[model samples]
Target: MNFKKCLRCGCFFASEDSVCPSCQTKDEIDKNSIRNYLANNDTPQNAESLAFQSGVSIKNINRFMETKEFSPLKNSFK
Candidate 1:
């Protein structure tokens, strides 16, 4: 397996995924949090607002928005 730098923790690991194994769990949890927030509330204007209201960091919000599952959400933002 090719080594890649973990996007969340900056650690080098052998994986095709963006984050390391440990961080993958955290990513799942954060994604759940975001989904819960969006399910109950109106979509925020942008990542910053979503991050603030969802208690997730803007960095993570931005990162999540890059994925195919969340890419449409990025288009919703200004």
Candidate 2:
């Protein structure tokens, strides 16, 4: 199996996903939080604002926005 570095924790692992298993769970939680925040409030101007309001880190927000699942959100940010 091929080993890849975990984007969130910098650990090496064998997986197709960007982050390790543990971080994947956190990513999901962050994603849901972002969705809920968007549902309740207007879209923020950028990742920093969204991160601040959603309680997620700007790094994760930026990473998520680049994914196909969050591609639609890309338009909402700068």
Q: Rate the local accuracy (lDDT) of all candidates.
A: 0.92, 0.91
Candidate 2 local distance difference test against the native: 0.91
What's model 2's TM-score? 0.92
Q: Give lDDT: candidate 1, residue 32.
A: 92
The weakest ten consecutive residues by lDDT in model 1 span: 68-77
* Residue 25 error, candidate 1, Å: 0.2
- RMSD of each candidate relative to the true structure: 0.8, 1.0
Q: Write the per-residue lDDT of candidate 2 for residues 9-78, one digit (tens) a residue.
A: 9999999989999999999999999999999999998888999999999899889978988878878778
Model 1 C-alpha lDDT per residue in residues 1-78, reported as the tens digit of each score? 799999999999998999999999999999999999999999999888999988888898889989988888988888
RMSD of 2: 1.0
Off by over 4 Å in 2: none
